[model samples]
Target: MYKIIIVDDEPIVREGIRNRISWADHGFECVGVSENGQEALGMIAHFRPDVVMTDIYMPFMDGLELSRHVAEHYPGTKMIILTGYDDFEYAQQAVKLQVTDFILKPITSAELREVLDKLKVQMDEERGHLEHLNRLKQQLNESLPLLKERFLERMATMALNEWEIRSKMAYFQIPLSGPLFVTIATDMDEWPSEDQGTDNELYSFAVYNIIQEIMDKEPDSAVFRYKGNKVITILSGSGEEEIYTLAQERAEEIRASIKRYLSVTVSVGIGTICRELKDIRHSCRASVAALEYRLLIGSDQVVSISDLENRRSKPLYDGAESENSLISAIKTGSPEDVDRSIGRIISELQNASISIEQCYVRVLRTMLAVLQALLEIGCNETELFGKETRLLTELYSFRSLEEIEFWLKDMCGKAMIGVAETRRNISRNQISEAVQFIHHNYDDIELSVKMVSSRIFMSASYFSSLFKAHTGKTFVEYVTGYRMEKAKELLKHSSLKTYEIATKTGYQDAQYFSVLFKKCTGDTPTEYRQKMMVDGA
Candidate 1:
């Protein structure tokens, strides 16, 4: 309802205006009546009426002055001026003050009714507009949760390009930008069994609410379900340290709350800070990767990639480069070469000047890599790494790295046997066997690429790639290198002539062997042997 205040010097006039019209019919309430503008000003402040009607000639403050004040301060307050004869000039100023509508002296009920009807219509439109804005705000609030989940869930699972990220960000009205996104993967420790009989949805939502209550207090963050029993929270802030601090603080709060109230343990895996939203999948993976350390670090702990990285005295070598060969070697190489290959990796770690702690970390990494490769080849983790498997417990119990190293070396040998039993992850194992064949037959003068590929049952084209993957060299390059090493061994330790050495190392034509040997080792067989003799002397 539109509220109205009547201001007049005459009491009768104020009552007459208040009672003359049916205010209810006109969608108005006569909230107050006053004898002068001063009293009416006080009423206007208190009631905040939408419309005001006042006589021009009042004590203390005239209606023209009141209209001027209301027009200046409360511009939205509509005013209809009251004037009598000889007050034509005051009416003129009222027009300049932009009063709503004015009536002359001896105001009639019909004329006042006409003004009230128009004011009622104006208030109706304004209130309806306000209601519309409110409805839109409510709808937006309802849809915000769905939009957040869609974007967060997608980011967690897949990689999005820059344009797609920007467009979705704009569409969802997320005010945050790139250069500082941190993903934290939070999981409940022993929760699946703890809450098995409870309402899953209610239980999850309760946990979610606790998550939001903890994470949303950060500068900018979004919390959503990452998967069953896990929720992902991505936070955006200024610097890497600041982001880490925020995520760490929030994670502590959540952990404490869950422990104190919920009686269950929740652990967090915080990733590295991403420089762009499009690359945030890396952060998500890192956070999840941090979770992989929960078992080593202990459950219900908050771990960061930096925390794990700091545990090691040096950076980890890209074991991925040698992993395929390691797996391949494990599958087909002799027990000695298999041990040597795993030793080579550990040797690399050992020579890097790492601390004893780093030795433990690298040993664990080596074992996990072997296990993951086994799993990739189609073996169940439980069969190999399940609770019943004593390898992990024994691994943790080792006192010295040499003992641990020896154990891991033997484990790799056993794992190769276990992996080869399944035949689950092959295609690359064929290349390993092809490599094995090449190593054994490099001394055969008739050995060729086609012959090796045929023996392995893999096409030459496929074998080429897998060989490069496993050996980091083409098949011909590996064969030649092996032959050159053997040729060098003969030159140093045997009295064999150059031509005899060439034929022994699988070269039928001595001249071609000389050229190939010179190309690979920068020396002909004779020159290499002479240099070896002099060095030996």
Candidate 2:
């Protein structure tokens, strides 16, 4: 029920209003009675009454002054003024204070009840409207992330004009505003088996989570999954070189985290940095093209288009097809495939009817391709070719096509082998570091896979897989087993109570510790202590 306060100078008037009205029947209760507006202001502050009825003429403070104060401080509270016929003009002035209603002196209870009934309906309607607005705000907040992702994907694919891009970016609250922008594309080097549908989904989800978590730390960067397989990230900064460096660092961290936690490798490709917002789509395309170079570069590494620009030499004799086939074969195919690809390129050169000088240029271009592949796979060219022999000068001296083919085959074969060995030897040091961290921090009650993984700069999922593979137990199982062993030692040898032992072993609840102890060791903490003592005796 809404509460009400009645104020009047005369004692009889105050008592009559309180005792005469059946307040509960009219959906209100008379919470207070005051002799003047002064006392009623104090009552209003304490009870916070929804409706206040006051007399127009009262000692210390009048009804008009009280109405003004209530209108300013308690705008939601409905006010009614009681006035004598002589004070009717004063009642008219109270209307300026937004008084809900005015009753002449000696008013009937029926008239007052009608006003109270109307006020109750107005309050109920206002409350319902407020509740509806709050729900809409909550729903908008919940769907904000999905909406932002869709807007970013659209921006990356479509050629939106600058005005449209700016408007949409503002609407979605995108933080990017770039004098320089770079896009990075990432995907798993190899997908899980088709039959393991659930595992594939989990791995994809974990990869996205890792990228999102890392990108969240960098300002003006956004990461989202595209077409279910690839993750696209866009980063904006003030300078071109700074943004490129930042992108490379973040991409490498993403690659390492996925490899460390998921036990799987991912390839990252970075596009040329651009200045205009509309050209982000171009960067997106370039990044995907760079990802294709993973066939030559090997996986689980960052490949930037800018890095390839200086190393790659255009085919000198329209042998682009043959050159591409040779690079692919050397990186992925067997030794025989490399030999056949080289022969195809030589035949194309021989059939061109070009001069010996042109032939030399084409052959040098092919040699450059070989060198690029070797560099991509982290091979030291100086070691492969002795420090004394300049590869290009030696290639220039070779007089016959057959001689050049033999040399090309030998170099390409070794490059293919180098690529294979490098991939096979992807580092396992991250897992070792994770194990050391867990052992050192085992007594921390908040110790977790995420905490340990973060300490070693890896993703939690990747770290969990490596931890399981290396220790033959999940992170929680290993930590719990270690804690139980420590608890067992303390119970057997020390006089500490069970609760104290629980605290030492990283458990906050002694009762929970006792329960888990019995589950793991087939005896409660106290029981285990007694059994050990008896057996020793």
Candidate of highest lDDT = 2
- Residue 382 lDDT, candidate 2, scale 0-100: 74
Tens-digit lDDT track of model 2 for 134-246: 99998888678877777778878898899988998898778797889999999888777878665787888899999989999987988877766789999999997799889
Steric clashes per prediction? 0, 5
lDDT of each: 0.78, 0.83
Worst 10 residues of 2 by lDDT: 421-430
Q: Estimate each model's TM-score.
A: 0.38, 0.35
Clashing pairs in 1: none
The collision pairs in model 2 are 260-462, 261-461, 261-462, 261-463, 262-462
Instruction: In model 2, state the lDDT of residue 110.
Output: 84
The best candidate in terms of TM-score: 1
Q: What's the lDDT of the predicted structure labeled candidate 2?
A: 0.83
Please give the range of 10 consecutive residues that has the lowest summed lDDT in model 1: 350-359
